[model samples]
Target: MELSSFLLAVIEDLGADLDPPTRYTRYVNALVAALPGNACALLKMEGKALKPLAVHGLTPDSLGRRFELSEHPRLNAIVTYRGVTHFPNKSTLPDPYDGLLEGVHAGDLNVHDCMGCALHVNGKLWGAITLDSLRAGVFDARVERAMAMFARLGEAVVNVAGLSESAAAWRPDTLNVKDLGMLEAVQLARHDMIGDSDAMHTLKREIQTVSRSQLAVLVHGETGVGKELVAQALHAMSDRANLPLVVINCAALPDQLIESELFGHVKGAFSGADNNRQGKFEMANGGTLFLDEVGELSASAQAKLLRVLQSGQVQRVGSDREHQVDVRIVAASNRDLAAEVKAGRFRADLYHRLCVYPLHIPPLRERGDDVVLLAGYFLEQNRSRLGLRNLRLGRGCEAALKHYSWPGNVRELEHTLGRAALKARRDGLGAMVTVELEHLDLLSELPTQACAVINSVNNAARMSMPMGEVSYREAIDGFSKNLIQRVLVETQGNRAAAARQLGLDSGNFHRMLKRLELL
Candidate 1:
């Protein structure tokens, strides 16, 4: 094929955002007029080294095929001069490009015959492209010109990427969320919450780091120890606070409508997309997009999301024209992404990028001083919130609060405090509010356990043996043991609290603990 057509094809490929693996060989073949005797290569600047970008002529057995940029004068000169550098005589060349190369020769590849061009775009050195031949004089004027042109094409492609970013900066989202990592307490704290525990301090610091960068952040925690609260704090402190902080519950959204909700659709895109619609990206254009329970996203949805994040562009469900968007993503999940990745249920790359800075909210039971501090803050807030006159936790109640293993984390605490406060505010009955949570009931969790027990009973009843006579007590005990073990893990080995939560007195709890061999 003619060298011009080859170079043109190379330009087209680069325009397609060519992947790294084959980009070098394709460019080398297109630029070198006559094929080099064996293998040829293109090396580019990376950190402190000029690593091989593409290798073609390396022996099926040649060692040290990769050459270092700093160690090699040829590649270094390419980075330094920001122009084409050729062999010994440049005075005989057609004309001066950057006039970069005067008397340079590539000695590191140690190949006797080769030329290289430095890739620069908007005055910055991006990389270099080299066209080498085993035979001397193989790269003629036509070949040299094509190499230079295609190098410019590579630069042009990078320039286009730069343009996309610049355009994103001017768009509503990028400009608004100037600092997506900030964790300012003023914007987030509804009441004065004073907690100097290590957990709280670490959380605050993470909030600050996430506030400064526009990257995906993953917030992980058990069922509500303030995971969503942390996400809200992120949004409130970020530059996008003024814009919509759109929150989507991936767990709640149905699979069928999730795509339409997230990416929007044209009129008639689906059965119910009657009118043209804008998706979450468009809605969250000028702000932070918070996705709760993101781990619940379907596999297909994860791929589409991965594409949007990778490209910074989104196409509506039905439409073909992809809208360029600038959206900062902050996702929260209760599941372990590492496990998900291992299970092949989640993309590894997406997991790393999303967890660029992971902030794991400590459960209430594990927050050290934050537990008391946050509980007090919630108490007062609930007081005003529910119009309670005067209610307080009794000495025993305070001890119970501190002693019980809060399995549901902050959500459980919130529910407990809110209900306790409401009960203490009895007016018509004229009942004096006592601090003793004797009425706290601590027994609401039984309905769930009872439901499980009922199911077990029904399954056992199918055996045709007299119901309740054949003691499946062992099975029930095993189930309880498993539940206890899981709760112990969640509570980090607070045995007393775990026993109290199981509704056992200290003596009975000890016996059960001994039976379970869980001293």
Candidate 2:
């Protein structure tokens, strides 16, 4: 067949009516089959594996498992060296896929000759197309010429078809855009929280399911995972968005003042109560009140707070009158409320109440490839923020963020990218805005912030935990305790404000703080 005819056929096949998502795969299969042979294959690269995108005349299950490029010396050789290698007889070359080759031979297709070409897009290796025939030595000079033309045409079609990124790691059918940029992903706000890995998807689904309710939610996760964002999302998407989203930091305030801050105090209620002040509850009336580091609330405070949640009423200090407040409570704490309850540090009833709905946000390290999406978002956001339009992450920055365990979660990433963009913009003197990963070096600084936090004793001591391999559940509890203690200090024991800042439910935050014995 003439090269032009083959090109036209392939082009037309791609443009034909098919499922919008799978059209490219269909085109690749059709192009590979047009060769004058019974066995033809088209493969696209995704991560470490070169996936068989389209196949025909080979066997029934030709596209089952992906062909690892590292295992296929011939294919790998072609892909690695950027050249197409052909041999008329199988015996002439070292066969990399020994078992696969034998299976093909058993199928009664004696490869007298074969021709294959590397598919290139953006001048880089994208994948390969191979045609096998039963006629020995049939792939003559003419066949090679035809294969070359097919490869060239295939390159254009592949590029235009938008399959240049390869089909394995980047299956658009599987890649929902919403999941990609989900920094604080949960099903309620957006759905595309993409990670096939068990841990990630589990967290994503849990967040989605838990997001539907107004019940006080307790989010337990590591420091960097976006807990507060989850709380904000809950409030923003819930029936309470139109009202105030009030935040308080239990750890940020003095222990004695917590009750007054949450329930509000009338003038002359206590020392320095010179004027009447509406507390967070009053401020957040008919809205969502987020109590972050909630475990830091004192026992007396917890009892009073529980009554308010249970009764939907609050009595101001120095006032006998109780006011009705319609507020949805969301609480977050980086502490183990159960442990606090056992230790007599937290109220069990409050813990149960706050845990009516729970959301756990995963850290950046567990988001898999979502790191790249978030990095891009941060990079762009920072670029605009710093007034540096050309600033972008270099290859190293991109790869570093992907591999780096973001201990601080989304906030850390945003800060790092913003700082890096600024540094890059300044260093380049406007010559280069593409930032290298010097900022990622900040990853090592995560532990420095994790020193001995004030425990329930309000005394500094390294937190004690069971030593040895632990489960995700255990890790979450420990991290929560550590984070609650730390955020309380950072936010100065103000639960409501801290909850807002950390994107967590204030009530749940209080529960965890209580459980962790912070109260």
Candidate 3:
């Protein structure tokens, strides 16, 4: 394909209505066809990282990975350079996608030729279009010039695709950057909705719609499904975004202290009170107050909470004066509050108040290949933390991850990768670590028929147990040893993480490991 024809095609497609991913992908595909490269990617700059928006000739998991400039020298150079930058065949800088090229084996992971040009949309640095070739000297001077022209078309693609609206929305003066810069703030807001699943798309749209109002929002999701993150997203996109978003876990406090925490108490009102403290409501005045585990509130606590919601006023503990507060409420729960209300455990009125606008987060098992994308995100994070040159999933690992029913959801996926990375490193794989299926340690959740088959086998094995031969103490000791050993392996030999999972004290766990001679 000639560069002129490719540019003309992109210009012609400018008026077509297409999704951002589809549009970005068209640009990447066209660029790869026109240029001399084995792999090409269209990345978007977000905060300090570069996220691949579209890819051709790269692994699917590559879409999930975020390349932080500080960690990826090649990407940093590409984005920092004024125009098209080409790396020599033997450049010392590491390739960010060393082993990510599609159809490439592990033995031939090195990218010999590379060139990229940073993209600018409306005079601001948007991202870059990177191309990599396996054969050396493929990206010569002429190819570099073509890349520069393609970058111009890439910028136009972003503009015509209507993504420039959101990209331009985050003005420096409007955002309150306490510790984050303009780029970081915009990036954080944009990347908050990470997945491309239909359920996730619906949830994102609901969040955007509900954020404009002051109605209380109830976030519903299973444990480890990131209900708190949903609350954060709601507050971040709300009208009161600039104001504080104070969070309080209702289940973390005792029944007696719930009121004191929700409504401020005067000094000496409580036994442990050393000074007059403003409660969560007062602290979040004109902002948002996120109540986590809201269904755990006691009956009396529920009444007090209902009163505040009804009156838009709070009376502190041991005080007669009532103070008015302009605060938006966002509550989250793992349990079904409506079920609790039906059972006469939760107040129906309080439930109604909080459920004015409800948002349900889809579980990991239902989000399809989003599991792999999320894994990619975690892999990059682990790579930086573990000080590795590169970290990626091994062959067939993506399929295994997608098929496993993640009962513990996103948190479990994160810990699983963290442990896998540790295991791969401990095995002396060095800087370039690959997490294989075995490293995942996923026990498939069996179907009913499969369980029946296992049950028959278990019965046969039990018949041969010789139950009286082993003493009760011996049986218990064996069980304990097996459990500890399994946990150690699952945690990748991290004794601290293992102890936490088992709900044991660190000191006690260490002593037990010593007693079992497994340390």
Q: TM-score for each prediction?
A: 0.49, 0.50, 0.81
Q: Is candidate 2 or candidate 3 better by TM-score?
A: 3
Where is model 1 poorest over a 10-residue stretch in terms of lDDT? 95-104
Say which candidate scores most in lDDT.
Answer: 3
**All candidates: CA RMSD in angstroms?**
29.4, 20.2, 14.8
TM-score of 3: 0.81
Candidate 1 lDDT tens digits, 114-223: 67777777786767766544355655665566556767776765455455545554664342223321332342343222344555656676676677577778999887
**Model 3 alpha-carbon miss at residue 11, Å:** 3.1
Judged by lDDT against the true structure, how good is candidate 2? Answer: 0.61
Against the true structure, whose TM-score is highest? 3
Q: What's the number of clashes in each of the models?
A: 11, 59, 0
Q: Name model 3 segments beyond 4 Å from true.
A: 1-3, 163-192, 428-430, 443-519
Relative to the true structure, candidate 2 reaches a TM of 0.50
lDDT of 2 by residue, 1-519 (tens): 655665777777655544432554555555555556646767776555565555554321234334446545566766665455676676554332221221222223334566578888897788888776666777777667767777776676667556432342255334233332233333223222323334455665555455446667887776656666666766655666577889888779786887788888999998899999898999999888888888888888788889998999988889999999988878888777778899999999999999887776666665544555555445545544665423444323433554455667766776777777777777764323556546456434433222222122112111222232442223445666766666778888888776654434344456556757877
